[model samples]
Target: MKKSIKISLGGLAFNIEEDAYAILEEYIESLIMHLGNTPEAKDIVGDIEARASELFIDLLSGMQTITIDMVSSVIEILGRPEQIVNGGESNGQSDKKSEEPKSTERRRLYRDGENGIIAGVASGLGIYFNIDSIVFRILFGVLLFANGLGAIVYIVMWIAVPIAVTTRQRMEMRGENINFSNLEKNVKEEFNKVKQNMEKRNVSGFFQKFFNTVGQILIAIGRVFGVIAKVIVVILAVVFISIGLIGLLATTASIFFGSTIVSLFPTFSGVTLAELIGSTFDLGSTLWIVIPLFFVLAIPLLALVFLGLRMVFRFKMRDTVVFVSVATIWIIAVTLLAFVLFFQARSFTIRETVRDKTELILESAQTSTIRLVANANILEGVDIPQKFFNLDDYSIANNNGKPMIMGKPSFFIGKSTSDSFELLILKRSRGATSQLARRSANGLSLLFELQDNSLVVDPFFTLSQGDKWRAQDVEVTLLLPEGKRVYIDRSMEPILSANQTCCMSWPDELVGRIWEMRGNKLVEIR
Candidate 1:
């Protein structure tokens, strides 16, 4: 049995052997001599002693006294005083300092508060993806357009990702191996960083203090709602994953089985989405539009899926490679999409109208009232078996084995400048230029006839063969003399303008009634 002495370590009483005490005292003296008497150095030494005290207790294992071997073991774990000062290069341990240590653990994401401007979120992402932090900063600034989405994302990251405070954690954030040498180096680097920051305080003290105060307030708010925030993040992540999966599946289906899947949905004139896109754009531009459109829709969804999974599972991926590759592809897709859209928009730059006028030969002696009726057989000979698209008084139909756009003409009545009745038809369309628009408008076919006191008008106007639909529309205005009455046919209900029927409760009520033009407005003649 050896002699024992009671000593206080880390506020705990420990019985130690005389020989063990001698070695421990020598180690403490050496540490003080090597690391100067600065406050930071004293704190570091105190931490080392606290760590050693805990190790000694573990090594005792129910023994009443700490042995010389226990002291040696504690010193080895904390590293010798010379080794800590020189990064493990003292006492024949030069190999440990010289040779690089292989990383055994994956890198982790941590906020670099020491170098961060605000909560260190951008800095953490910068380290994770191996990209410059300024790039992310600019990206966040741009995202501010989406209703402050950038600020929301930054706050979320600030709360979710922990700050790296310890030497081991700092090393892990940088993907470095955790060893004695690395730990010592990390500590020294942290001290140097602090010193440099202190020196730079005079340069930007106001901004630094402002950010610090705001950061502290935000952190306090985050701490108060930490649990709730985590729950919200999990719920949002799940929702995003679901949306991403559904969108990805739909995009894949549209790309691979365009016709089969697109057939289920209603399109312009019974045409599938692919067929419509192909018809709208030329073949050379189609590929550019289609491929980039797919990626433009797909990349973000895939990223959402990956991010959700990462947050849920806490797994590591090939972050740098995946991020750079996907980001490059997304950027290219957006560029191509924007380029295609710019030129396509030029196609609809101008709008023009083609007008026609007719003098109605109504015999005032025969009747004071005129009959305005619609031609029921508007699609008379077209082989269209079913109507697939009908919107805004326009529809698509098959005209002689060719798909054609059919639009119902808008009808209105007003006072005539003269004592005779007249009809005006205006065909309007859009194209690349005024001339092209006029040509498109002229291609519209509206059939109507005036005989005796009755007017017969076709409800629908058809596009001429081989003419593309450029929003072609027909407007028929009837000018009636004062004291002259006209009976509107029920079939004209579909083409009657809503603005012209505001005096009536509904558009349908205005049809199948006799009305007279008085004071430039049509009044019902009860």
Candidate 2:
């Protein structure tokens, strides 16, 4: 039989055999010294005692018998003198305090913590959990980071947990003995009044009214400012987004239309590459613009009117009228601006000047001498057969040493011009250099100068979104059927001749040879 001795460990009333109680107290005290006399370690010791009780009961096997050796046995099973300890977590709450925010956080000090940069509650926490202070600090730092909220929360914690000045206060902060005698049987219970008081978060009486009023005012002001700020931010964001969209639309139009779009719409007459580039495609049209305008202008005014009505039914319409008047003015201004923009985009087109040209000539000769003057070497020394002007599209004209007496016969046509003409005669293909005749064409125009060089783009071709075609006049001497002279004008005769369009041929031996009326004599360009 085990006789019970009345003793208290850390203020917890315990009835155990004399030897068991002494050993238990000694063991718990040792734990406290090691755990910095914190409330958490005290809690762990209590758990150890309870566990020992159960172990002791199991050993007895149905008799209400207990033994100190049984408690020692439980201690050994738990591990070494240091290892004989467990964390201060209570029944079924091992992960709760670590994971979730406690209904009451572990503040720096007792009574909701005061004057401590660190959570004194955490220190007391070390006592309650019987964990190391360093462990708690690391754990807190990690939790703070993992939460993803900024460091403001940690600062809040620093402010909330109290500092422990006195030894008793420190103990209380740890949920330990407020009075040394009451330390054990759950010190958390002893601080119930303080905890409840902390729950209400009652600060000094002097601060109470002042803070309450200040907080209320601040909240009201903040709400109003927040409303305005949110509105502005949304407005700005919408504008930015719209601008980007409009720009994209313009660029897409510019690429596809090129000069064509400006050619079609007269409303968009002034539109250019710059206009296309500058226009923002942001379509805040119809509902997007109108709905927002209604709300922005109406909400505040309605609220004011409602408040005024409630205050005095003597509801003078003057202020409401004033607001409406101002809003109307703004609306009119904006609408006018929109109308102006709409009107500006009317009708448009794109037309411009072009000057590059090429001409081919075939002439009649009286002698058998190879007359490859203009066409002689005209097609040489120039970039031709370009993709822009498919040389395959160019028509071949043959001018043998005979006039129109032989219908398209007597000499083969094989030659080609640029700024100056070079004509050659084509005969049976010997596949040698001697097969081609020289001096095959005569100079046809004054400014043209027997040019065989392929047409180069006019350097000063002016491009515009307009349409106009001016006609040019050219002088020509023609060979008629009666061997007489004939003058031609495009205005008078749209077609120079049904079969012959002022024909010329290889009638000269040198390049740039011009024909004169000095009894049908041809001369070379000086």
Candidate 3:
């Protein structure tokens, strides 16, 4: 319950206890009396008061009142007024230096600008942790691979850490005594460091003049190239922003309105664009997939746009809060997207194939030629146009029951070991396991009928309902006996395998032509 008084020192106000105020006031009077009433003396006194005010502020921290102990500590740090002789150290300073106790002030973190290469962060950390700066430098270099985390941390530290400028500050930074002895030693060390740096830079030989000329020329060239580099950077930034914006807009549109837009066209029937995209990869619910995907696409785009704007405007963001928040979110989004992709990848790990072979029934046993015709009525209920159907690998179709995935089957001709003609339908699909793959492959249905010697095959094969797409494919191989002739209908041109027509200049040339199987190869009868 001590009384407190309000006072102003060095234009900074303070609420100090009565005892501390009396001590501080007497100390100021002693400083004024020691150095007479000169302008230089006044300036020195003002500086001392300013330093005392700062010490008081640091001691107070959250407290509102300065105590006698705090005043004593400040006086000790600044030194007693009797120690000054002609505004400098007195001869008695050395005699009393031995009686002064060592300063127990904890080391304060400050950037060591004098011994630093780049902003002094690593050197400051080295001083604080009592380790070599090279270790921190190496750690930062290694962490640069972790999404440039080192650069971010370095920039934040550089912004937040203050450089040690004053002798007292440097002393506190090293946890050294703050008395006159240590202050004087710190000043000498600073002077020696500057002298050494100057000595290294100062050269008086003819080589110095030559090197100076070369340096000047290099600097001049650098200025010219710097402008060009800036222009190139601006151009690149513009390109990045444009690409980011376009990609972001396109992704948003695809997620929300893609199904509506695709419905206008006659490309896919009985399914929306979202369903088609979902069919490609199975990732739980649509929301779970969309949220992570949106962030993964949009965050990078937004970051690119922000970077470009920053570059163009030449503005700086000192507060790292916004940057840190955005970076954290971006990292989370990337991790989630990676997880979703990994989970979906498991669905296609195993591949299984199912095959079916049926003997072709001919009405006439004496018929020597088989005419292969394409059935156009296979897609009777499906509303997709022929041009659109030809372009797609798989599409959804109404199969009079539920919408089913259908794809065109590839056709090839092979030599049969038996005299009778044979047809093989090989269905291939992928799944998470061999069993699931087999199930998916077995669900495929291929339609074909033989009337007399003429064979009609559907161009498309379908997957049963409730089965998702897993790279389902169907191959139709006709095993023909040697010397058996077959005629290909023009409608079958779309389903013919490219390998069978590689020798022909045009794939459609195989249509409407009679081909004879000779020695496991189909030879065109021109």
- After superposition, the stretches of candidate 3 with alpha carbons farther than 4 Å from their true spots are 1-220, 263-273, 282-284, 376-380, 384-404, 417-419, 498-510, 518-523
Positional deviation of residue 455's Cα in model 2 after best superposition, in angstroms: 31
Scored by lDDT, model 1 comes in at 0.76
lDDT, each prediction: 0.76, 0.37, 0.76
**1-526: candidate 1 lDDT, tens digit per residue:** 7898999886667889999999999988877777676545665566567667778877976576889999998887766756555654554557654565566546799998767887787887788777888888888888877679998888778777899887666666888754344555667877888889898766657878798788788888888797787888898889889999999998987765655653574342354445456545534545777789889899999989988887777673336766889899999999988888787777678999988988788766657688988987776777544634565777665455456677888888767888788898999998889998899899999998876678989988887766666777899988888778889888778777877632543569888898887776678888
**TM-score of candidate 3 relative to the true fold:** 0.56
Task: Output the lDDT of residue 416, model 1.
Answer: 80
Best by TM-score: 3
Give candidate 1 misplaced runs (Cα > 4 Å): 1-231, 254-256, 262-269, 282-285, 360-365, 379-387, 390-394, 397-402, 417-420, 449-456, 501-509
lDDT of 2 by residue, 1-526 (tens): 6578765433333456767766766766765675576555555565555545545545656433345876576555433344313433343455534542222323233422332223343444565465665676666678768884434444444444444544345544554312222233234454464578788874556555664465456556656876897676666555544554565455456544535764575334323332222221123343334334344444444544454343333332325565687677667656755664454332111212222223334243331122222122333332231211111212111122101100111211222223212222211111112211111111111122322322111111111111111111122222222222222112212212223222343322222333222233332223
Error of 3 at 523 (Å): 4.3
Residue 20: error of model 3 in Å?
A: 23
> Model 2 residue 168 lDDT?
43
Please identify model 2 stretches exceeding 4 Å from their true place: 1-195, 198-206, 266-526
Backbone collisions counted per model: 0, 81, 0
Indicate the residue-level lDDT of 266 in model 1. Answer: 34
Ranking by lDDT: 3, 1, 2
